[model samples]
Target: MTAPEPYAGVTTHTPVRHHILSVLVENKAGVLARIAGLFARRGFNIYSLAVAPAEGHARFSRVTIVVDAESAPLEQIVGQLNKLVNVVDIKDLAPRDALERELLLATLPVDDGNRAAVLEVVANAAASIVDVNATSLSVVLAGTPHACDLLERALEGFSDVELQRTGRVALPRLTQTESL
Candidate 1:
């Protein structure tokens, strides 16, 4: 048989499942390193990761990690995480129970021929034009992953584009009777 097309299987029929893990760890030097090393050793991929100090206590930090469920079983990942000395707690936040967002910055070459068109694209997506130089325009988009993806696609129409996206950060969605 002839060779299959290069991108034939890029899209799969089944949706990829991901799990959002909220890890609380001691906010001390090397804690992050230890956790990252654990994932490396286990051959698990962290799709997205964000870390920040937890509320009311500088001694603990919260890490939000997104992992492909198919890459490694949930129980295995959590078990390995729990074995770490600095890990204090792990909460698996289901998609329905969490709010997630990512930020993207894009710079595109803009000349008189395409400046207005680029501005229109940014306005249509509710993104902001953060800076404009003689030869380039920079934009910032902070929103849900889908929204960011849409903006990125729109910007691709322009040439000489540079883009950077922060991996997702998520928090639990609070119910009516719940409080943070």
Candidate 2:
């Protein structure tokens, strides 16, 4: 009989589709690289990483990672990640208890022809323009995640996007100390 795959248990044991990785670390250069390298060296993939400062000496980074790995690898990664010199805390945020997630977006191609529709569409989506340039516009939006998704797709219809990105910030419905 043929052997089963190594990571097949990922589907059987756990069913978490997406994860928010909250990590606390000391503020220093090369720390990000070390953390990133750990993921890459172990065949772990990080979908998105957002690192910023926390109060006091250490820093906090909320990593929006798509968790799609076997239980063993997941545990190993977590264990090793904790061993890093500057790492203070590592936790995986769950989706069910998750309450609100804000997505800030910046879009471009803001010439005379597309500005009207862009504003109208995003306004309906509850997004407001924060910055406007001769050729590009930046918008700040706070609402349901679907609102952000819809706004992005609508902007795509205009033409090839000059630049676009999102800030994925999440908070659970009930505040928790940490997650495993």
Candidate 3:
């Protein structure tokens, strides 16, 4: 038979869902490295990871990790994470139960000829122009992952555009009528 199309079967092997793990850990040196090393050694690919200090506390930090579910069983990942001495808590958030957001920043080369068009696209995407210079415009959008994706795709139409996205950071969704 003729050579199969490259990566034609890739989808068959790819995971259909991603797991979000919210891990609280001691804000100590090497804690992140240890966690990353564990995943690397186990061959589990991390889709995205974000870390930040928790509740303005110096002693604790929160790490949001997105993992491909098909890489390993969910329970196994949590169990291993629990064994880490620095890990204080772990919450495996289901997609429906979490509130997720990402930030997108893009710088686009603009001229008198295309400035209006570029601004129109930004407005349509609900992004704001944070900086404007003679030769370029810098835009920022903080929104859902899908919104960021759409804005990125729309910006690709302009030449010399540069884009960066913050990996997703998520928290459990609060129940309606529940006070924080």
Q: Give the winner by lDDT.
A: 3
Candidate 3 lDDT by residue in tens digits, 50-151: 999998899999999988878888888889889999999999987667798989999988887788888888898899999988999999999987788777
* Model 1 bad stretches (over 4 Å): 1-15, 176-180
Instruction: State candidate 1's TM-score.
Output: 0.85
Put down candidate 1 lDDT per residue, 1-180, tens digits, no spaces.
221122422332112788889999999999999989999999988888889898778999999888878888989999999999899999887766778888999998887777778888889889998998899989999998778877777776666789998877788887522334
TM-score per prediction, in order, is 0.85, 0.69, 0.86
Ranked candidates (lDDT, high to low): 3, 1, 2
Local distance difference test, each candidate:
0.82, 0.62, 0.83
Residue-level lDDT tens digits of model 2 in 107-138: 66666676777777767778888877788887
Clashing residue pair totals per candidate (backbone < 3 A): 0, 0, 0
Candidate 2 scores a C-alpha RMSD against the true structure in Å of: 10.4
lDDT of 1 at 142: 97
Better of 1 and 3 by TM-score: 3
What TM-score would candidate 3 get against the native?
A: 0.86
TM-score ranking of the models: 3, 1, 2
